[model samples]
Target: MAGNQEPLSPRARLAVTAGRAAAAVSRAAGRGSGSVIGGKVALRLDPDLLAQLANHLDVVLVSATNGKTTTTRLIAEALRANGGVVSNALGANMPAGITSALAGGSDARYGVIEVDEKYLDTVARDVTPKAIALLNLSRDQLDRAAETRMLAERWREALSGTKAVVIANADDPLVVWAASSAPNVVWVAAGQEWKDDAWSCPACGGVMQRPGDDWFCGECGFRRPVPSWALSGDEVLDPHGSAWPIKLQLPGRANKANATTSAAVAAAFGVPPQTALERMHSVTAVAGRYDVVGYRGREVRLLLAKNPAGWLETFSLIDAPPAPVILSVNARSADGTDTSWLWDVDYSRLAGHPICVIGDRKLDLAVRLEVAGVDFQVCESAAEAVTACPPGRIEAIANYTAFQDLRRVVGN
Candidate 1:
């Protein structure tokens, strides 16, 4: 592998020799075999190795507390529609995960990646994406990422000298504020329509004034203007029932933001706006994210709610009458060690409705439900919970781990 040269495929004949050598090194060093996703091994190799993998390709990095995966997929789809192939292995964001994607040379000229917030600085440092999309920053996995403000500062530092074209959401005060320092930044707001008024000024903690749905700091005088690109006009319709006719295939307000950011990124990459819209409109679905399924002659909707912000977005998407709703919580420290964040969620939204509780921490969710004044039942296991509920139209909300458990229960 030399300068700007694509690396050999991981499945190539030489891959066996490389795998054996890697296995020997791991064994001699007393390490476990690496984990795999999309049939590629994710390992922490030397940083210098990144130079050898996909040197000829331009990396497009998308980062956000929410919507990163959906947006990355959306942008990749547009690129593909315009005759550009893309390599985005399963929702992998870590540096090692990226290395794995490049292990198999992509047929496309561009590489679209959904990067995790904590790993953004590291990936940006090594990959130096040709373009970067910054989505809204909301409260999330405090145990893992600390404060959003801190993460913003670190991203700023990582992106300092990079020549990547930046496409950012103007609605998020944190994202807009960070974009102020970028070299070549293009602000993409959901327009005045989807602009949220309830936001605090990042600089002085002053009350942000809302001229309609748009927000600006009264004291500090920092205003977030509407972006040039948007999906809906000034009044964003809250799609309550089935998914709307938006350009994005995914449902929910958060996804609207994802569509907006992804479209802007595609345009920045020189994809025409009309072409971008056509490609985006062609998008259908992404895994574990608003992923709809059929099980035992019944429809099942699977959504991933990892943090409070993510939960809030997911909660608002369920509009129909509460029909046998099953809520699963994971107690394990790894899935979410403390599980204390449940208190922060607006469970009151489930108001006076029946909800079945299951998984490792059924009591935890039950107690929260009790506080919220919602009716509920508890089952020893997810299997019993699903079987206990009357089979008809069912709405299930489960955390990351509990989601997997429920999937097994439904025989998926």
Candidate 2:
């Protein structure tokens, strides 16, 4: 439809039409956005629909354990400086949802895709992206997704000798190893705050040696690559040794790292660093993340953290003590059914803060908090949690489904 270069077969056209109809029905029924279900119906009718829809547009796939949606949003915004860009702005990173997004943006010249960590290879094989951004990989949805090393190995295999420019995070050992096999790579020192999953080398399975910010494997010769783009404090240094300040409206160092990666990917698409950063700065919130809403006469900021690495980054983003904190968790199918990852998060960080816990898995979180010697109140809902806190700005951090639940409750 949008890329009319090579016409779709009659069956493919029918599949697209059917998918749109299903999506509209779903929306009318108030089930959900209908992207995933629509894409599923389309793909079931035409299994090759994704490749067909992606044929004419330049595609860029962003994949990681965390930050996929935000980075994809930033990249899409930056690429808009060049031309029309279509993306799954919702947190859907699987093939079905991706197909729905591409089909919907038929007039877009570029497609920026946010791919789930495990689905990266599958999406890449289909879309034949112009560039791939490999951000840091850590343990996430372990019950459903493969281990970090296994995922990295798959990525390395998928990217071997790829024609697409691979923009990778050099600071992430697993990411470096995965992109090592790619023929074209642009390394960026985006920084990794959580290193629990990357302590061993993906190449040799040997203990990794980290001396300051650099990492290497003594058992094997694997090591961190010298990045062409590096983030230092609040500025990003381009390959030309030019430093550009990362002035994004997004909060936390994690977002700064994401912004840096976004700038590099934008550069690959011919957008100047300054222009891309300028465009990115306009993005205040991403898919309800960092959205501050008034609730119970208190400002509640929504933050999503799905795994250990994500929780680590989220801890840094929360407002300090007096602001109060609400932590919510759920182990629904969308979120991994395994709640064991709770043990890995350092809930002790909220030691001095007024803490409130809610969600389906509040008991699990409460136990973890109790073990950490943190004071917290178990609440049945976000409203109760907010009511327990003093009237002021409140930070609400939640896991996948819990975050969505909180968003609905807050009407954001």
User: Could you say which candidate leads in TM-score?
Assistant: 2
Put down candidate 2 lDDT per residue, 159-192, tens digits, no spaces: 9988899999999999999999999999999999
Candidate 1: residue 301 lDDT (0-100): 70
Off by over 4 Å in 1: 1-45, 191-199, 233-245, 331-334
What's the TM-score of every candidate structure? 0.83, 0.98
Candidate lDDT values, in order: 0.67, 0.91
Model 2 / residue 234 / CA error / Å: 1.2
Q: Give the TM-score of candidate 2.
A: 0.98
List model 1 lDDT by residue over 147-220, tens digit each.
77777777777777778888887777778776667798877755322223236777677888877657789998
The numbered model that scores best in lDDT is: 2
In the order shown, the candidates' Cα RMSDs to the true structure are 5.7, 1.5
**Total backbone collisions for each predicted model:** 3, 1
- Give the worst 10-residue stretch by lDDT in candidate 1: 234-243
In model 1, the Cα lDDT at residue 160 comes to 75
